[model samples]
Target: MREEKLSVDIENIVKKWEGKKGSLIMILHDIQNLYGYVPRATSLQLSNYLEVPLARIYEVITFYHFFKLEPPGKHLIQVCMGTACYLKGASDLLHELRDILGVREGTTTKDGLFRLEVVRCLGCCGLAPVVKVDSKVYSKVTKDRVADILSEYEQEAAVK
Candidate 1:
């Protein structure tokens, strides 16, 4: 039933962008926004519906950084790697997070609690060594604070 709904949604999106130039990217963006990641099955369905090849779909998906082949975790941890942040020990914070979460950058935790990523900047240069979890930003982050910050999220999950 869910698959059917997804197919319908994809079809609607395709229809909405049909006959337009540069529609494939737009269609794929809609799919990604809807499902968090593009499922292989959905891409296959899109290939058939749009009369485009599966290889072409995969090419587009892989070419774009915004697209994800796998689903992300509940919380996204973005460590800033800008010059300001890097100079302020952001690398240590990232390493500490990997140790505490047991997941490398671009991968989610086994418990599906966090996904770690490194971004060039978060636009808060004044707050160097910044770490953002979901929508909340932690400034002046330190390696020692990694455990405490994660504990806060773990506690929230437990309460829920």
Candidate 2:
């Protein structure tokens, strides 16, 4: 649910990557950062600006897991599944999330409040079972704590 379409103005972005090797990916990264996703219209504009084929732009976007084709939810919940976290009950945390949010991994909730993703590591193994909500990292998370974590964001969104 984003309401805005692709942006038509990308002159600055194009110029920054001008003449650089693999500028397409760099340009796409900036576009995603600006809009949270790569809009089809914007991609077309980029194609015309760079004189690169539309297919090539899409190829790069599709190839990278970090690039998104659609707008993301308000909050991104990343559960670290690193060795320590897994051993400490990351699987249970994932299951708890599925039950509470009614969404599968790598998907956003129906209300667009939260998106769940499982990351390989967050570099916080000492605090196993880490659940990162946007920029905030919840260390030593438990299956039971999942509800509390989500409710915090939900409440914050409601207040705003």
Off by over 4 Å in 1: 1-6
The per-prediction CA RMSD against the true structure, in angstroms, equals 3.1, 4.6
For candidate 2, the lDDT comes to 0.86
lDDT of 2 by residue, 18-127 (tens): 88877888898988998888888898877776778889999999999989886788899998988999999999999999899999887888898988889998998998
User: What clash count goes with each model?
Assistant: 0, 0
True lDDT of residue 76, candidate 2:
92
lDDT of 1 by residue, 1-160 (tens): 1233346788788888988977999999899998888889888888776777889999999998899887888889999999999999999998899888888898888888899999999999998989999999999988888999999999999999
* Candidate number achieving the greatest TM-score relative to the actual structure: 1
- Clashing pairs in model 2, backbone N/Cα/C closer than 3 A: none
lDDT of every predicted structure (CA atoms): 0.88, 0.86
